[model samples]
Target chain A: MAHDIDTLSGTEVSRTSMPEEKRSDHALIEATKSGDEAAFGEIMDRYRSPITNYLYRFLNDYEEAVDLAQETFVRVYFAIDRYHTQFAFSTYIYRIATNLAISEIRRRKRRRLMSLTGLFQSEEDTQVEFQPPDTRKLQDTELVEDERSQIIARAIAALPEKYRIPVILRDIEGRSYDEIAEIMQLGLGTTKSRINRGRGLLKEKLQHYL
Target chain B: MSDEDLQNNEPVSRLLGELKHVEAPSDFDFGVRARIAAGRPAEKGGFRIPVWLAYGAPLALVLAVGGYFALNSFYSVGDANVPVVALNEKANVAAPIPAPSREVVSAPPVTKPDDQLVVKKPDVVSDSNVVAVKKPIAKDKNAGGGSIDLASRVGRRFHATPQIPAKTVLDLIGAKGSFEADGWRVQSTTPNSLAERSQIQTGDVIESVNGQTVTDKSTLRSNTPLKTVRVRRDGKSVDIVIKN
Candidate 1:
């Protein structure tokens, strides 16, 4: 395993420990670009979990996160020939995932607008379809810890997207500020400000916890 | 003051660290493989409709349907100014042109080849308001009185009455509505007018002409036959049928 301390945000960009025989992402992509299924499979195995987890934090909804993550890979697989190796592969894929998440958010908004009248038409419709995820799977932690965790998730989710993306990428995923800036297509100063603003918002929301 | 923020920033860092980590479903890799296998045909730019076209097709379909109906109804202008071609009246003895009331107007039962009769009968529901007239024909001067060959325009909206000469060109534009509200409001009717004969009143609110909701005065076409005229009067709806 190799690691680099990211001074921009003062966090570590930890590389995944790869096997000796493991091919590089760009190499696998090149092979896949030439129609090699095995190479593509190797690429998929390498990044799926991180991409999925990234999306999950961004969306705050597991089902939608997973769907968008899968869509991100599908897009990558289709556009492999166009994947320039000048940029890091992780940054490239994370950019794709971020775009997919933004689109999903927009879609949810449009859906809400389209059927706003339906909300009051039925009492059953008032109830949210995606219940705050079933915490039943977890062992008995303190009620306060579970509640605090949910509050934090909600607070993070509620942050304005400009703040949310940078904050999550920096704080939760431990991504470097430069990568976050590149993934978000924003200037580094702007990215840093957004993360700070997001943390300020979370701090305000979790005032009692602090 | 979290200015030169560290990875450890009060509660935000601790909270993020403690938040649950989610992994891709176990079947995600298999799903990806299956999708790749299924989507292989697309690699060659095979059989897939371009993204723009896929979305555009439905929008185009809706517009096409809307345009067809709009154009069809547009050209199918109802005969608002329908001539009274009374089948039962004698074809020769032209009755005087009539004007009586806003609802139904009929002149005195006077017969003349050229006099316009004016009379009033009932509000609506009356065939007595029809004033039949004969179209005068001039026999050919070269031939005898028993000859044909009376000349006429190519097309005209109103048939020739004994009084007025037939028009040559089609007046594409007709009279606009006098007033319009929810639909068109009947401002006034000519004495023995087509609208008056159809039992429409000055105060009647014309809701929809034919089946379409009336927008403004521009939508009224005198050439098209009035199939169904729904009107709102004194808080009640009344439908008038004007047959040619």
Candidate 2:
């Protein structure tokens, strides 16, 4: 069934009684258009980490993830004139981030394939993985935590793009199936099935850890 | 990733229940905000001024003022006896000799800076004369057009000052997540850090530090570098050298 965004957002217009902290994302976005910079700041404050973390899971590199996340918001700010308030702001932000991540992955793949020296590199070394430069030393507890994170990250990275994207959005970021479907621009049933298949693949990789 | 969140007794969900939340760096919002503000077009008012005007007006004004002075000077040079002098700035030459006049007048020899065209228009009516007149056509590297001088920060000692490691301890506070069930694993090593110098790699399971098994958490201490570490990398036990 098609979502009646006009009806839903119209209902949200009556939410002015809510406190500043309790104001909806739609309200914040609308506020941004009327020359309210603080409203835009609030929007960034709310979504920056979620979007950054989502991109981090997708790209595996925190720096690139942060960069893309910032780019996403920059695009949002510049194009606020064109953005219709009818849609959910969360869905809009996530869709922008998802597109950026997928585009970057394709770009990196093209760059890697075009490099002459890369032809001589080992297949394992050439695999695109999220391995950020981390030099900080940790004790046992933190070490164990870090180790688990790396294993999970690697397993997710190993998943094929079709499965990896949905899996990361579902498990790591906890995005709903409907939102993932909208972001991925797929049928609702297909999104659920892919998430399930992705979970099965993740289970195989993570069986030993559990 | 809780089993309930998945809406069934799913084993994968149970295992993924402890999945770590990715925290954006504290500076994340600060950066995004700066970009947003920097990218924001100045709010459009009732009247929208063309963007080119912001830059073009000042440039046009400068050219207008410069052209006015140039034209004024060009018209003021009324003497037909004076010859135009073309000075090759790249080459050095002595004071250019003037064409002889009917009356031999003794005046102090005026020296002008290089690249300056001295159009010595001798005053026929009075003793005074214009010496070393500027042509204003620039030929030097300092000619202010499209050229950009790159200021490089290479090898300036104050700039070369080594960055203090933000990390307070030598103890690895970073990703320790690549380990197997029993031993500490090396996920990665930064290019010039102690880990890379010690020959650690992604799958290297650190078995011992200073010949002592890693079962002891105190094996790593602040500022006390380890020596003779052993790693089980690629199905073989190898000694890793740690240079302080």
User: How much lDDT does each candidate structure score?
Assistant: 0.56, 0.55
Top-TM-score candidate index: 1
The 10 consecutive residues of candidate 2 chain B with the worst lDDT sum are B146-155
Residue runs of model 2 more than 4 Å from their true location after superposition: A1-21, A117-145, B1-9, B40-244
User: Residue-wise lDDT of candidate 2 within B122-211, one digit each (tens)?
Assistant: 222111112221232222212211100000011122222211111111222221334356566666554434455456776777676566
For residues A1-210, what per-residue lDDT tens digits would candidate 2 score against the true structure?
A: 136887777679868655656678878777888989888888888888888878766766667777888888888888887887666788888888888777777666544544556435566754433222233332224223567777776677666677777877777678788888887889988887788777777777788876
Under CAPRI classification, how is model 1 graded? acceptable
Lowest lDDT sum, 10 consecutive residues, model 1 chain A, at A126-135
What would the TM-score be for candidate 1 when compared with the true structure?
Answer: 0.49
Worst 10 contiguous positions by lDDT, candidate 1 chain B: B165-174
CA shift of B223, model 2, Å:
80
User: How accurate locally is residue A53 in candidate 2, as Cα lDDT from 0 to 100?
Assistant: 75
Docking model 2 quality class: incorrect
Off by over 4 Å in 1: A1-19, A117-145, B1-10, B40-96, B99-244
Q: Poorest 10 consecutive residues of model 2 chain A by lDDT?
A: A131-140
